[model samples]
Target: MLVLPKESRKLFKGPFGILHRDISTVLPELAGRTVYTVGDVVTHTLQKNGITPSIAVVDGQTMRSPCSRMPEFSGECIRVENPAGTITDDLVKALTYAINHTPVTIVVNGEEDLAVIPLVIAAPEAAVVLYGQPHKGIVLRTIDAGAKAAAQELLGLFVRVGA
Candidate 1:
């Protein structure tokens, strides 16, 4: 494991464990694992922007409401539709646009069905994903080995990337 300087290591002892150590290696790996969905991307972007996303409501109607009142975030909002049935060029284009755009931190709040938003919105080269419950500090199903690994990797990245 990589070690930190004395002051850095001390700061990492408790809840700060999330922000400890060599994270440059972790961000890119985590970005690869994130699934594509609108809500998930928005939340991930918000977090990256340094705004603690308090919650996400999944219903499409909620997304329709204006985000004017919502606090500022680091990333753009993206929409993701089911790939098999309703996927369209427009949606894909939107995802590409969002991803190609600059990084923005955001807290995602949306319906469960749209959880993959983060993956689609992130730049192909950028290693970031939305796969956790910020409030509970949990992400991707823990029992699923791949999912867990992806989440851990993303968490490591987020700690350093949030700046």
Candidate 2:
């Protein structure tokens, strides 16, 4: 597992990609492509808008609170335990598997916020990762060399931990 140190908290404060209040404009362009969503609100929104993402990472909560509406996915469900502000090996494995197996929902027991970091690093070119930015809006990250590099930079902020 890797822990996000206190100093790194501020590093993850802002959206890492383009922010959109309305995700509809981006949805139509993503048809027949590998799209990923990382948050309950965004995942639920995609499902509601009839755009089923290829792989979605959700923690069953929004804004750090138990969400009243949980995203319902018909495909395979992958469960992993990753505490808040930390990323575990289990989470990485699940994400790697989900990327290949389309239409999967990865339900994180603790939190799914940091999952996007590894995901951006693992995502293939041309694939888009959309996540919610709390009250701000949705963030759309188009996976590519730059996105991977940015994610790697953030990954470096984490301190590796042992069992």
Candidate 3:
């Protein structure tokens, strides 16, 4: 497990890829690529646009508030518990499993915000990982060797918790 330090949290503010106000604008780029959504709003927007992600992670909340309704996904739903500021081993394992099985929805019991780190690190090359950028828009990161290395570097910044 890893916990993000308060001082280092700002490093995660920037987007990992291109930003789009609407998911429709990004749909054309996602064709023939594995898509992983790290937030509920991003997953909902993609689903509303008729694009089912290869793996969708949602915590049933948006911006720390309870979502009006859960996003609907047509694939198998795997539930995992990840707190607000920390990533657990369960999350890493679930993400790995989801990467192996396409069209899986990871229903997080806590927050899903930081799941993008593992998603980017473990996703196959050329896979697209999408997440909401708060009030801005959706950030789309296409997985590559550079992206994987960058995500791994960021993960290294997180303080390991427990044994």
Predictions in order: lDDT: 0.33, 0.90, 0.89
| Candidate 2 per-residue C-alpha lDDT over 1-163 given as tens digits, one digit per residue, 9 for 90 to 100 | 9999998899898999898878777787687778999999888888888888889999989998998777787489999999999999999999999888877899999999999999999889999999988888999999999999999999999999997
lDDT of 1 by residue, 36-137 (tens): 222443344444544333223122222345333333443454433432212234343544554445442223222332233323233342233333333333
For model 3, residues 1-163, the per-residue Cα lDDT tens digits are 8999999989988887889987678889999987889888888888888888889999989999998756796588899999988898999999999888878999999999999999898899988999999888889999999999999999998999898
After TM-score superposition, what is the CA distance of residue 113 in candidate 1 from its true location, in Å?
4.0
What does each candidate score in C-alpha RMSD?
A: 15.4, 1.1, 1.1
Q: Give the poorly placed runs of model 2, Cα more than 4 Å off.
A: none
TM-score of 1: 0.31
Q: Which ten residues in a row have the lowest lDDT in candidate 2?
A: 24-33
Q: lDDT of model 1 at residue 52? A: 37
Superior candidate under lDDT, 1 versus 3: 3
- Model 2 clashing residue pairs (backbone): none
In model 1, which runs have C-alpha deviations exceeding 4 angstroms? 1-85, 104-126, 132-163
Off by over 4 Å in 3: none
